[model samples]
Target: MDGHRCPGEDVTVSVLATVARFLARSAYEIPEKDLRIPLERITTAPPSGFVVSGFAVPPADRSAEDQHPA
Candidate 1:
């Protein structure tokens, strides 16, 4: 129903937020050659898919507080 929230909404939101945060803090590079997207397609997406290289999560960016909450 429109008035009621889906039971899985909270979990889905949490998972998405966690993933977004992880991605935001991660260091990665997308090659310029891989930036091509086909606008003619109904779903405009990269032909080779979104590719990234040298992906890493810097230890400095992650603090002990983030790993252990008080």
Candidate 2:
């Protein structure tokens, strides 16, 4: 067994699945240096969303002409 099963386990699994899906579709790896975790605040509450900061914008998709560079 991975660990003791707890209440709201389904919700936890769902959130992790969503994050995994997003990571799978993303091309770049999310660096730890850019993360800002609020360690001062701790709560045993549901829907505790996280905030991400200091990320660079991804490059724009190039058109066929731009790719070939005539």
Candidate 3:
């Protein structure tokens, strides 16, 4: 019952674990200097929440306070 086969069972924990494993693998492959997860990120609502599986970020919503602040 490995991570690859866990998705077939449709178990929530297993699915989450598989996702974590995939993220871990990605972290391992990518250089640390290139990785960035903002410490200020908040997932309570839109614009800052996670995106997945071809869900596009709408063009009008801006997460930060300013787009081109000086």
Candidate 4:
């Protein structure tokens, strides 16, 4: 057998590869690679006042202490 999911085969990477190939040919394009999200980013907070995406530096104040560049 060509390692296909005939009936009760587990849905492992092998089966996915075969299906992906078929879809790519049918769609007239190579299958797009999986874009894995960065796991470390998931637990972290996003930037302030910039919508929820990733951490960002807070806006600087006009005080003397804030005058120092990081």
Candidate 5:
């Protein structure tokens, strides 16, 4: 290891990009609620974990390979 770069960094970035793309195209609604994170907690997070509803996956976003499996 010549530098601090991780061997799986490229794979990690690719996976994250794929996930972001999927989420961007997907349709969903997050209910209105107090999403404030309390500073007192060590692991900061919303009091009630993020809640999503009315999710609808668009057929047009699916790739041809996904629509027809080998």
Candidate 6:
């Protein structure tokens, strides 16, 4: 039994499935790196919600970097 498995349970596998499983297993331990894809850049103004009788700009999460400027 693989060490990752629950105790007393046996897993079935085929040859190709075994190779695929090994690659997938190693991938789990690799650290993920953050990337700035263009789609990730949110350059658009976020839709404003109703505030102060639906007139004023809504309050935002100020601590966050993606806040819209007044």
Q: Sorted by TM-score, highest first, which candidate order results? A: 5, 1, 2, 3, 4, 6
Winner by TM-score between candidate 4 and candidate 2 = 2
Candidate 1 vs candidate 4, TM-score winner: 1
The C-alpha lDDT values of all candidates are: 0.82, 0.57, 0.48, 0.47, 0.87, 0.41
Q: Write the per-residue lDDT of candidate 4 for residues 1-70, one digit (tens) a residue.
A: 6766556455676789876655444423233444444458755443332222333333333343477756
On the 0 to 100 scale, the lDDT of residue 67 in model 1 is 82
Give me the runs in candidate 5 sitting further than 4 Å from their true place. 63-70
Clashing pairs in 6: none
Steric clash pairs (candidate 5): none
* Number of the predicted model whose lDDT against the real structure is largest: 5
What TM-score does model 1 achieve against the real structure? 0.60
- Colliding pairs, model 4: 47-54
**Root mean square deviation (Cα) for candidate 6:** 22.3
Candidate 3 lDDT score relative to the true structure: 0.48
Q: How well is each residue in 1-70 modelled by candidate 2, as lDDT tens digits?
A: 5879888989999999977765555465433553345666675322334445554333442343468786
Candidate 1 has its poorest 10 consecutive residues by lDDT at 56-65
Tell me the tens digit of each residue's lDDT in model 5 across 5-67.
988999999999988887888899999999999999889999999998988776775565598
State how far residue 11 of model 3 sits from its true place (Å): 0.4
Candidate 3 lDDT over residue span 10-70, tens digit each: 6887889976755554422222242345557663344444433433333332333267555
What's the true lDDT of residue 26 in model 6?
A: 38
**Local error of candidate 3 at residue 48 (angstroms):** 3.4
On the 0 to 100 scale, the lDDT of residue 12 in model 5 is 100
Write candidate 1's Cα lDDT for 1-70 as tens digits: 5698989999999999988988898899987766677778878877777778999886855675598877
